[model samples]
Structure formats: C-alpha cells, structure tokens
Target: MMNGIEAVIFDLDGSLVDSMWIWKDIDIDYLGRFGLEPPPDLSREIEGKSFSETAAYFKERFSLPDSVEQIKADWNRMAWDKYMNEVPLKDGVGEYLDWCLSKNIRLGIATSNSRELVNSIARVHGLEHVFQCIMTSCDVGRGKPAPDIYLAVAGQLGIPPRACLVFEDIIPGILAGKAAGMKVCAVEDAYSLEQAEEKKALADYYISHFSEVLQG
Candidate 1:
C-alpha cells in the first residue's frame, strides 16, 4: 500500500495484539482489591505512557499507599501473565508481516509498554524474529505524543522518519508518529473501532485490518 515505505513501525498493545481490553479489567480488578475504583479517565490518561509513568499516575491520583515502583511491578506481573496466556495476534497480522518481510521492508515496534511485557507477547506469538527492533517508551525518556520512542525506533532501524510508516491504534501514538515526521496509518481494532473516524482525523491513512493493507 505504501509505495516507497522503507520501514514500518507498529504499536504493540492495540495494533498488533488484542490485549488493550484486558488492561481495563486488570485495573478494575486490582483497584477493587484495595477498595478503590479508577476514575473514568484513568485509562485515557495512562494509555500512551510508560509503565512507571502510568503507575505513578495511578498512585498519585488515587492516593495509593504503595510506591510507584511497587505499583509498576505489580501491574507488570499481572499484565505479563495475562498477555502470555490470553493475548492473540489480531487477524491477518502474521500474513501482513510476512508480506512486509517478502518485500524486504524493515519492521520495528514502538510501544509504551514495558520491555518485559513486549518480549513476553512477542515470544508467545513467535514474532521475535519478525521485528528488527522492538523499542519501549522506557528506552526513551518519553512516551507517545512526545515523539521520542518513535524517533528512537527509526534511528535503530537506520531509517529516516519520513521513510517509515507507523501503524498506530491510539491518538497519542498517531500524534507521536506525526511529530517524528513519519507517515501514520491508524489501525482499527476492536478497542479503537468506535473512535476510528476520530483517530483517522489524526492519521495519514487508516486500515480496518492488516488484510486491508495487503489488498491495497
């Protein structure tokens, strides 16, 4: 679909894997244990932040007794288990990746998720070999909407930002890619389809599924 795209960058959680919804459940279940409930905007606030950033947001906002590091570790443990056991690749992602490989386009992942969680999911889905580089927001000083993570991934791949096409599921990620001077394609998965049009407004392109890219 991209005529001269030399590299493709993907967002892990909601774009490549169907695990975004699990986070909401995890937050509700975990907070309930402490007799607390997250605010309706909690997820939105943390959606494009690193693990520590998200945990710190929760800690301060909810007045949690645990330290930010402790909350991050706890959340990671819970998320890693769920991801390794239950998250599945979105339909046609594997095939689309194979096509990119065949076309000799470099592939990389730029995510706000922790490295451990990203590795666990890649290992479980046998995608460790598919991506040339997998970068987490923690690797950079900032997360999505800041452009650092995406720019880092492009640098790692030895590709200029304009030569890369980023596939994102959230508005922050789309903004990040744009800020990095990369073309952005918004991927509509179950979690983001309701706001697909809104996301598209910020993206250069939009695809309902990976198959749609292949068909193009």
Candidate 2:
C-alpha cells in the first residue's frame, strides 16, 4: 500500500513494544500510593498525551499533592525497570529494522513517550543507533492528532512528508501521520483490537506485522 516511502517513522509504545498491558497496572499501582484507585476514564484521559502532559493531568485529576515533575519522576522510576528488561520488541520488528538499515532506509521515532523512557527501552534492546531521529511530543508543542510530532520527525530526517511512511498501532497516531501528509500503516495490537477496522480505514494500509511491508 505504501508507494513513495523514502523514510519510516514509528510510534514506540504499542507499535514497537508489547508494553501497553503493563500500563494499566502501573496506573493502578501509582494511584494506590496515594490510597486511590484508577478512575474509570483513566485510559481515555491519558490516551495520546505526552508523558509530562499525562503527569500534569494525573496530578490535577486526582488532586494529588505532588508537583507535575515529581509525579513524572515517580512514574518514571516505577516504569524504568519494565521498559529496560521486560518490554519485548513486537513480532518481526527487529528483523525488519535490520533489513531497512541495510537498505539505508532512514528510520525515526515520533512518540508521546518521554525521552528517558524511550532511551531506556532502546538501551535494553540495543537499538540506540538504529533510528536517525528520536522525537517526543515534548520536543514539539503537542501530541498526536496535531501533526506536530510526525512533521518534526520528517523535518529532521530531511524527508518530505509524502516520502515518509508512518507505522502506528493506535488511531490517534495514524491520524497524526495522515495529518502530516505521510502514508500511514496501521499495525495490529491486541490492546487496540476493538479499533482495528477504524485504524485500517484511516490508514493508507494495515499490516499484522512489519514483515508485510517487506512482502509488499
């Protein structure tokens, strides 16, 4: 489905790693520190937000006494071990990235996650040198659905928007890529299974794994 992809931009969380399932547990546990349970809308409220943005939201939403930066620090400490040791690269991803590297295809990461967490995962996976650019919404002004993150990635990669292919697992990330005038490929993730059809409809293509792009 991709026709003019000179570069590939990826979303990190659900797309690159099987890490989403652990987030709800983190949220519950983090809130439990303050003797609170996660709110019913916790997932919805945090969806697509930058790491710092989410921390601020949590502080305000739960009336926590901690400052935004402190909240972020606490969560980062909680999540660092999981990201470094337990997060597995999604199926076929390492091979695909290696293949793309051999072909000199520029790769970049544009994510809502913080730079520290992204680095932690990269270090553990030994993928620190793979991406030409690693950007977060904090580097730009907004998160997904605003187009800023993808555009920033393409800009730094020195590729035109139309020459970039974005791989994402969630609707917001897909829309962000499309909004930036890039071709988007929606990847399957069990956490987002309910929105599979919506993802395919919004993306330029949909694939179960990165190897599908090699076949294409």
Model 2 stretches astray by more than 4 angstroms: none
Model 2, range 131-167, lDDT digits (tens) per residue? 9999999899788888999999999999999999999
In Å, residue 206's CA in model 2 sits off its true spot by 1.2
Give the C-alpha miss distance for residue 50 in model 2, angstroms.
Answer: 0.5
lDDT of each: 0.89, 0.89
Q: Each prediction's TM-score against the native?
A: 0.96, 0.96
Worst 10 residues of 1 by lDDT: 188-197
lDDT of each residue in 1-216, candidate 1, tens digit only:
588899999999889898899899889988997998878778778878987788788888888999988887888888877898889998789999999999999999998888888998889999999999999998896878999999999999999999999999998899999999999999887776768888988998998778988788
Q: Model 2: how far is 85 from its true place, Å?
A: 1.4
